[model samples]
Target: MKRRKFIKKSLIGGAAITMPFVLPSGRLFASSGNRMADHVVFVAFAGGVRQQESVLQRYLDDSQAYPSAGNIMYNILDGAPPTDKIVYGTTNYVNGDTPIPKMLSQTLQQQGTFFKEVNASVVGHYAGVNTLLTGNYMFTQGLRNKPLTPTIFEYLRRLTGEKATKTWFIGNGIGNSIPLLDYSTHSDYGAQYGANFLAPIVTFGNSGDKHLKNAKVYHPEEELDPMYKMKYFLDNVWYSQGSALPNIGNTEEEKLEIKQFVRDMFQKKDNGSIAFPPISDSGDLQTIGYACEVLKRFKPTLTVIYLSNVDGCHGNFSSYLRSLHRADHGVGHLWDFIQNQVPEMSGNTTMIVAPEHGRNDDPNGIKDANAFYGYDHSDSNSQRIFNMMVGPGIDSNLSIGNENNKVGDIVNIAPTIAEILGFKNDIVNTGLLASNQSFFDLI
Candidate 1:
């Protein structure tokens, strides 16, 4: 066998042996329903966004007591860019003073329904994201523990019979228990129904380059026989101890495809062909680039991207502002890529963006180099957030709720996604969510 082909086969065979496990028996019946769209992309605009800085577009007016006020997130919100005291773009222009050019002709708020104000009950990162994915304010959820309830991935896969590859949880990094969110520990829906998880930066960065960029082709008889026997022996020993390995239940074909996709991504990176935003400086931007690649290659029925670079507000408010600005740019790029590059998902995908939680109304007294005060999340203002959706069957330029009248909750996102994908009834019937109402119901 050719060396490349042998390496591929060897990796597949080795994975099969080392990760041997049983697939969960999903629900006996599948839902028979019509989908509003063929795909759903959920962006967890997380890391404690503040309502004053974000939806209010207060810029420096509310946060720093500076009279200057304008929108810094022009791609998602329909507002003019901030005019003065700019520090949220590439330094190549003028000391990071010039904002990145908007990628979308029309803002997402103009193209979709925008919930100006939404409620998030949880303030911490882990609980906040857990609530977003599971649609429950799991106050008991620990920072180190997997979700206590079935995540949306499990709900979609088990109730609708979607394959593992058709769903994904692409996290920015493998920190703060992000990889665990792909699945939950729920009895009815667990590993078998989990989405494939990838922290692409870690997977494709220096660590991957060092460990996975090359593989020696091991001869089947001379090298593989002993490895297979050792794997089986270890599996038996582990199983005998009443423990079993967790698997996402990717079929051999799906595994091979994923492996090949990883290889292709590395090659693309080398050739400067990865579909990154024009300015890919931050970790969030790089993650978004990989996310675009995933969308083009898999065209998944459901894909969740988590970005948290804006969490820098804890100490460096200027950097936080820059991260928030770049996040908006990345989102604009992602939507533009789907519409113009990924034909399979173009006009057939519903994209939803919501922060897991909001930051405090008051600052923590820590100032940045720009003499800006840092903020944390722990007050009522932290409950404030916004949710936006754009796609077929959704109303255009419709603005709902406001600063005084909140129309939706963070928990509504999972069912909203389920509704878009035609599985809302199944998900709601489980009686697991805090709010059974989808965002459509609010309309």
Candidate 2:
């Protein structure tokens, strides 16, 4: 079948055959409280960022014992760019010498509130993200298992009755148990209230080009009938065995929209029309590009984009610095696209950025090409990170906390998102959160 025709017909009959089923519970009632913003974009500016390099504006001084001290993350923080040992930018004959031009006219710190030093109780990747999404430390949460408590996606969907497509979790790739974060194992809120998840790089990269791009559009009466029977049989078997199949709950209409959006992305990628950042070299930058597409296409009430390129710090500090700089560039592009391209989310959206955790203060004996030592997480220094938010009604050019005084916890992010979307009462009243206070309360 022709690709366009396949998309149209697949929308009509593909739900039954699609794996990881979509079994939407009927929508509840709308939220009652007033919303601070029509939409919220939470960037898990993740991958174990170090406070010295990011928020402290110390480029090499703190990490390498160099006299140089300036910010490489110029788009998010208000500080001058590094003047020496410029190894964190795009290549200009010499490695990483040409910094990507800033995308936002003003830094996010200037446009919103900045939490200089936030506490991240969990230092590991999965646990830190679990804390950020569930608002509970869940120190016992297993690496490969779903979250023990309900995630913010669950609270928002269950309380506000938002559609599956209205909440999204866009991961850079499906590794590190990224695909499992859409929902949780909570009895009260599991797959039925999960967010739609997409690891765009995998979905649109080489594997997808071979498997999903030209998926056959099976005839409904002839081919779909047998597929449906098999699906039902498998689903019944799974259920009878006391196991529930994962369901993202995308309604038929939403599914159609999602498929169409995927098709459009492939075409856009081919034509070089994706809204990629000016320096779309790293995985994080590519992920941010697809994230921009998601926002433009879905206009979701809550969208979480996870970028982990900076995790390279474990082995290559130079690459980590480059990733960190590119991350800031990508974030600037994302915010700029939201404000200028996506009309629906332009003025009414709130953007929040926070790393899941921080890297250690001391080096781990691994040195990069620049003779700089690598850093690992697992100490008091790893608990230190920063959070920032920019949107309507949020104070501009405001900063809270300091080196000696930490202000917010990683767990506060979930409740902060709930508060912004007018579902804080619903989320907090359940008593499942580690702390009910949002960043506003901390302020």
Candidate 3:
């Protein structure tokens, strides 16, 4: 790695983006640098957010709503302590000295920072996630899985020559595609939708990395070489042995049926996998847990942990609060593992936690806030969503808008990360960076 090339921008064309290292394909690029947090763990809250309750804490600041009330997380804490809510839950809108209101309570503590005055273009499912993840509003494409634009992950890979194999997007219904995931430059490098645009060698998925599946199919004697051995074994013995599998019927049709059994062979005991038990059928939990486990092993330079259950909980407000807290707890756990559990990663890593978008302020029971009788996201102030970040050299005890109605735009995120990672690339600066204004200096 050419650590020198990644030095501060003063040396190269007046730009500084990280370390300049040569990629496997022999291209020199800059990376955020190999610090303890060389691995970026982005834990997403994954839902249409509610500012009044959790991160926004509007209900707290306004004494009129509930003079001494606490948000969902603080309310659940053992003593229902005050600091726990403000500190851990970014409880500024509520109270003070509650031990930074740690969401996991067992993990790290600190309010991190909040971007309160933020809004989105749409309240619909895909649009919310698209803008949040891509850092720019993607004009509605009518739910056809169109990404707003390329994402941070794509930029990271290009600047450093890292493959999608090193990145993981853990969610089912997210709207980011090649253009969004890869930033319209290099097509390969996303997990789920990789093969569609790039070759499998560079872009891959969990389906190809399930340990239990490898164990089941290639049992004790056949486990020596999982993929390759399975291929060899099937080639030599599949056609010859049928009666032994008689229940499956001995015919070309049966043979095809038997082979189809391996269709998703060892795809990580997923809901779609044969090895999955009924209890593990819930796709959301399985995905969250599986992706976290994968991160333990690969620890990719860039990773995204997608928790999409929050959107459903939005329809039911109380349940939605718990959902948000649980997701926050999940992020706290990931952060803990990096900062303390894994000492080397302590200050080197950086994390950003935010929701796909804001939910409609619906007092009435309805799905679409914009429906005839309902109001989802108002063109007015209440409809915008907010985001925050914490970890490694980040300013603790700081609040972007310690007060109410503070506006933090979406474009601020990508360039901030790009700036931290030291990417002088033009798009992030021109697109998301320029609009939102990077928060690099603040942290």
Error of 1 at 117 (Å): 0.6
Clashing pairs in 1: none
Supply the TM-score for candidate 1: 0.90
Local accuracy of candidate 2 as per-residue lDDT tens digits, 306-349: 99999999999999999999999999999999999999999999
Candidate 1, 161-265: lDDT as tens digits: 789899999999999788889999998788989999999999989999888767545555677678878988988888888777788889857976888898888
What is the C-alpha lDDT profile of model 3 across 249-299, one tens digit per residue?
123333333233333333433455332211222333344444544455445
RMSD per candidate (Å) reads 10.4, 10.7, 12.5
Q: On a 0 to 100 scale, what is the lDDT of residue 18 in model 1?
A: 81
Candidates in order have lDDT scores of 0.91, 0.91, 0.47
C-alpha root-mean-square deviation, candidate 1: 10.4
Residue-level lDDT for 221 in candidate 1: 68
